[model samples]
Target: PPATARPAPAPAARLAGIWQQLAAQNTEIADLTAIKNHFERVLAGRTWGDPVLLHGDLTLRNVLVQADGGVAVLDTDLALTGPAAYDLGFLDASLDFIDRWQVLSRGRLYDDAGLGLARMALRDGYDAGGAADDVALCRALRLLQRAAELGEHVQRTRPALARVLIPRLIHPYFLAAAARALGVG
Candidate 1:
């Protein structure tokens, strides 16, 4: 089996702080500027009601199925107090974009029916009618956050990759998908 790309999880609170800092200090990157402003607009006058401890990243790669028919969750670095829908949105988006990543594509779980079933199962497992609104918001937020993190990662470790990653894909995708979802565009 190929190794999973489970990047270190930074808490939602920390991410918010970083977003603020970036907005204040880093005005040179056009993508970051657009994303920050979009999120600011999308989140304006909105409040996350009662944040709870979330697994943060709940993709299939982070789950372990044991011989005893039990499951073990790994990669807790991104765990934090946030809307529970954050986890759900990440899982759902993982399904929607599974084909986008090499390792995830290997799982071959990108079917729409499968994704719908998985989301249904998730709602049932949580015994909630589904946090529809928060899920939508979190889905957009998570996408933007992931793109931002990837941009930072490439900038720090693989500076050359930034030229191809930032404006070309990450930034645009994040801005479009998130802004569209949030009706901010």
Candidate 2:
């Protein structure tokens, strides 16, 4: 294991702000069974490899970009204990969300796909102790979590942006929620 990935926060608290904001607008399922199901699955999973002192809350935000096109990490909260794959996944997911956001907001001017190429390069950079599969899992987690945030954010306060964003999200959320239910990613 390496000190890169981090464990995801419990969904309830992570999504709490959103839930509060959407308490009025979101009339979907207050039953919360789906959300509960997700938590249950996440809590039941295990590492395919030995756990290491991971960089808890691992993501690109913790990785500083240097002027020379390199990175310097900050905030070693030291709570980073988990499988190395978790770090890979966390970085992938954060980068992916940022890329998708640019495209969603700025459209043609922002090349979201560049994130994919960057991810591959980063993956290659970490080949020494890399587990791309685990990284992919982390990335997917970030995507869906951030996506849920986007939904709650736009629908609550930024209705205009929500007009553009919500339509783009419907299908992705459906699949992500399904995958979460299965505990596969």
Candidate 3:
């Protein structure tokens, strides 16, 4: 059977979905609510350009080590139109999980210091200085997305466990990350 792709929703709609998820699950605790408000504030503060193609899931796992000693990207099914820093910020967000980059690029790209340096280099190379706020917004969006997904799983699968995990663990982490993204941490 042939498959048809649905158009990706605008960024505001995507964020609204996250908010709806939080409301539906009654997971809008003070910390999470604050984070959400700050996230929205950050988004509102930024000036966005016309949406462009973005790798929605730009993680290390989606990067391929080509045979010719170059690099390639994979699993682009999630690609869609969004802010340019959506993908770039995703790389930054996923730095903690990117154990390696490749043969020649592998040493410490995942380390905190290394990631910071890499971010500066990328910003310089791309001359994307103005995209810093966009990157922060994207990072907050990523955290919210994760928290929303986890909230759904907990609500549907383990309500009791969620009571302990959501507030103490998941929500706190998301809030802290979002706060850092907003430069308020």
Q: Estimate each model's TM-score.
A: 0.64, 0.46, 0.71
Local lDDT at 13 for model 2: 50
Candidate 3 TM-score versus the reference: 0.71
Estimate, for each residue in 48-148, the C-alpha lDDT of model 2 and write its tens digit.
55455556555544654443445445787756554465566666555545454644664544343444454454565555454434554455444545556
Top model by TM-score, which number? 3
Q: List all candidate RMSDs to the true structure.
A: 7.1, 6.9, 5.7
How many residue pairs clash in all the candidates, one count each?
1, 7, 0
- How well does candidate 1 match the true structure, expressed as C-alpha RMSD? 7.1
Strongest candidate by lDDT: 3
lDDT of 3 by residue, 119-183 (tens): 55545533443444477667677777777888788878998787788777776777677677767
Candidate 2 error regions (>4 Å) = 1-46, 56-61, 64-71, 77-79, 100-132, 159-185
- TM-score order of candidates, top first: 3, 1, 2
lDDT of 3 at 174: 73
In model 3, the clashing pairs are none
Given candidate 2, what's the lDDT at residue 87?
A: 63
lDDT score of residue 27 within candidate 1: 27
- Tell me the lDDT of model 3 at 156: 83
